[model samples]
Target: MSMYNEKVIQAFMSPKNVGAMENPDGVGEVGNPRCGDVMKIYLRVRDDRIEDIRFETFGCAAAIATSSTATEMVKGRTIEEALKLTNRDVAEALGGLPPEKIHCSLLAEEGIRAAIEDYRRRRQGLPPLPPRHDAVCHHEIPETGEETRE
Candidate 1:
């Protein structure tokens, strides 16, 4: 069986908004220490909405696909709307992802939230938020059928 579905392959082959923005209003970067997959998202916000979004990712096919899908999901969406997005939403948008690669989708979700949070902090004249190191494994292991550590 194919490791990736059609939607995931499409996004990986031709990722949308792949480059970093020249002068982004906000930026969020997240990395998985276990897999060494890193994702950085840039946002252009106006009127509390994401007018444009872009991403740069260093990882496997699933990571690239997740970043591409996440950017597309949040573009033109209000901050409130974008904040509601979850890793499951990203995976569903990409048709689905392998159990082992699910963490990639979680990174994408965190990237968007971090960028928006940075934008809000900047607007309020507050310092940038610290890097996020929280675990992203809230899903059950498909192989062992047991809960994994965070």
Candidate 2:
């Protein structure tokens, strides 16, 4: 077997919080089909702080390790603190990721932010996050195959 960084191998081999929560206050799932990586995060919060976090992932070793590390980093942290977590942090915590697998760290970052957002919206009685305007596909034609501007 090829040698791997001890930290990365440790994280991948013995991931922390590596299960689903029974009743999570917030859940976030993100997948990158391009790379065949998917991550699902579950969190339980109290007093606007994360009390518990868990994750299930279907991806490469780096992806799994990132998700596992992210779960441990966020628990017991306030929403604000958790949001401050960056992809760099997770990668660094894991002793760094290979260039080819960097996107896995990004997915980990997105998963954490997404989970935090879900928890905030639920706690504040707010609605789901608004979709970005650019994400909308307006197929309606205005006149003679011309697209209409919203």
Top candidate on TM-score is 1
Q: Which 10-residue window of candidate 2 scores lowest in summed lDDT?
A: 141-150
TM-score attained by model 2: 0.79
Q: Compute the lDDT for candidate 2.
A: 0.75
Per-residue lDDT of candidate 2, residues 1-150 (tens digit): 224477878999999998889978888777644446778888888988999999989888878888998888888999889999987788777776665566677778888887778777877898654322222222222233221111
Worst 10 residues of 1 by lDDT: 141-150
In the range 36-143, model 1's lDDT, one tens digit per residue, is: 687889999999899999999988898899999999999999999999999888988887787778878888998999999988898899987666655663333456
For model 2, what is the error of residue 110's alpha carbon versus the real structure, in angstroms, after optimal superposition?
0.4
